[model samples]
Target chain A: MGIQEQYRSEAAALLSSGEVKLVIGFGEGSTADRRRPLFARTPEEAQKFVLDAACIANLSTYLVTEGLLSDGKKVAVFLKPDGIRSVNILISEAQLKPDQVVILGYAIDKAEITALEGRNISDFSLGEEIRSHTPPPHILQEAERIEEMNPAERFEFWKAHFSKCIKCYACRQVCPMCYCRRCIVDVNQPQWVSTSSHTLGNFEWNIVRAFHLAGRCAACGACDRACPVNIPLRLVNYRMGKEVIDAFDYCAGENSSQKPVLASFKQDDPETFIL
Target chain B: MSEPFEPKIVAFVCTYCTYAGADLAGTSRLKYAPNVRIVRLPCTGRISPMFILKALQKGADTVLVSGCHPGDCHFTAGNYHARRRWTVFRALLAFTGIPEERIRFSWVSAAEGAKFAEMINEITEQTRKLGPFTQYQELQKVIETQSTY
Candidate 1:
């Protein structure tokens, strides 16, 4: 059976047995080209579960929104590798609990699963898919090149791009990791980011949003995908991801037990930049 | 529009090291740019990324974070944590197009009064060449106008 068929059956079995209150997965959208997030409450509904390249929505975002894991019921989530990482991070951040959610992982290929399990991927096809599916080349290249530029050039490049933003907040709304009950930008009293779509407010909003996700973002590409104007928002997150890894050898969501890089301290961490 | 530009520099100093170092600089009668306004925190670890952006939004042309040298932190590892956080924070700042020189991190022990003075001199001189942080100011204005609509 195909992976999708197996996942559907397993989810159905779990739901029918009352093992989980809800099984969050993907379903065929009204159109063939699209897929939508699915909340399977019954074994019969599990037939709607589908897994494909179009299943790109990070369903974990709904863990809070749809109240799937609420009411003190165990919720089961079907996670792709990226989704697994996001789930792990969310769990570590106390956003979700392990017993509260059960993860059913889906690998595009078996060898990819092996690699994730800390085993070598001997299958060339699986390896190729995983390699080709890594973060886009332009993001990696730009991240490296940006580090080489002097501060002024770096500032100019970002300002030029951010000036084009319309303050849609699509990036903020769509990010699975941005689950704050009230975002700083939305707070009116102190007025963190201006409520307008002007250049200064736009830039500040983008910067603040990105910084807020620092060391917590799983580099899931949801923000970039959700942007209406196609801002390369992941570039900011990816750049921070690289720095976190380089400076502390830390990767978000990789280990459920590890403390987040920004939230905790190590006596031996590098402080060469300190005065 | 040839107004004399005075860069607004926000310096986040850890109370243990750089904050004490700045006090020493003051007590020793050392001279440095008066452009910087210091925000003293218990440790570098307490300096959140929000504070940096807040400083920028409030019209700081540059933001500097100073703390104890690695392994020299009075809290034993506060500066180490700060370093890791700033490493990522700095990269995010750069990616957002904030000028790199506008944000910096340094280690200055309580005894390093001369280094603190030199650091300020360097940041002030570099910021002078880079000019004011107009991009953020311009955005702030737009945000203000939109809210009125």
Candidate 2:
């Protein structure tokens, strides 16, 4: 059977057997080429399940949405490797219980989608095998290009990019890890971050956005894809994530039991810069 | 001639170590540059990177984060955690083109009054040499001058 037929059958069985109350997958969007998130409760609804290159919404974000998890019903989500890593992070952080998530894993590149034989977050080790793959060449080149520039030129580069921010916050809204009840930008008591989209405020928002996800970001490129202004937010996140893994031998969501990189530290962490 | 440039500096220090060290420097008559204004917190771990950005946003040419030495945190391991955090935060700041020198991290124990004074003198002199942080200050000035519509 083709991959879409296989996905449809698996979703149907899970839903009809009452094993999963909801199967989150991709269905036809308003346009012929676009796909939207499909939440299926009945076996017939599960027939609409689609698997293709364009189904890249990282549906795990819905697993933590406002009213989804409160009911304690089991949820099965169609996932790519990036979505699987997000499940791992969410489970490790105690935000989502492992028993509550059933993952239908798959792999996708620019033009193809191939399903994997994993039904849960643990099935994909996400270990050295996954980490061995280097970052995309374009992101690497842009980061290195920025690194090679003089500090002033780099400053100007970022300033021009950040000045275009309209503070729509679609990036934050789409991020699975950005599950805070009240973000720092919303708190006005002393106002930890400015809410406006001015230059200084934009700088603070973008910096904090990247910093908050330094170690925890799943590197799913969801935020970058969601950015309205086309900011290279993933490159900054990739740089910080690389620093954590290189400096501390840590990779977020690689292992379910590992403590978060920033929350815990060793006695002998490198600190050459500190006086 | 116009007055020489004096860069404003903000020092976020732990009450247990660096703050006490600064107080000891004063009591011991140790001389240091008077450019820095100190904001005392409970421990180094309590000093969020946001504070550094806030200092710069409010016109401080440089920001200093001094805390207990490793294994000497008042809360036990706060400095260690802080050291790791600063390492990552400093790297992020540098990646964003915030000159690394503008954010200084150090460890100054209560008995290290001399070291505290000397470090302050060095940071103040370096910042003064770097001149005012015009890029960030320019952003702040624009936000202040603009009408809130």
User: What would the per-residue lDDT of candidate 2 be over residues A15-116, giving only the tens digit for each residue?
Assistant: 999999999999999987789999999999999888898898888888888778778878999998888888888888888988888888888878888988
Q: Report the poorest 10 consecutive residues by lDDT, candidate 1 chain A.
A: A118-127
List model 2 lDDT by residue over B1-149, tens digit each: 99989989999999999999999999999999989899999999999988988888888999999999998998998988888889889888999899988999999999999999999999999998899999887874554565343
Clashing pairs in 1: A151-B100, A155-B97, A199-B139, A200-B139, A201-B139, A274-B106, A274-B107, A275-B106, A275-B107, A275-B108
Off by over 4 Å in 2: B1-3, B141-149
The TM-scores that each candidate's chain B achieves against the reference are: 0.91, 0.91
Per-residue lDDT tens digits of candidate 1, residues B1-149?
A: 88899878999999988999999999999999998999999998788777888888788999998888788878877767777778777767766657667788888889999899989988999999988888666665644455433
Please provide, for model 1 over A1-275, each residue's C-alpha lDDT reduced to its tens digit, 9 standing for 90 to 100.
76788788988988988988889998889899787888899999999898876676676777766455567787777766677677767777877766777666665553333212311111111222322344778888877787787766776677667767888888878777888889888898877777767777777788888777877777778888888777788888876666676777777776566688787867777655454
Predictions in order: lDDT: 0.76, 0.88
Best-fitting candidate, scored by TM-score: 2
Which sections of candidate 1 miss by over 4 Å? A66-70, A109-133, A141-153, B1-3, B71-76, B139-149
Best by DockQ: 2
Report RMSD (Å) for each prediction in the order shown.
Answer: 4.8, 2.1
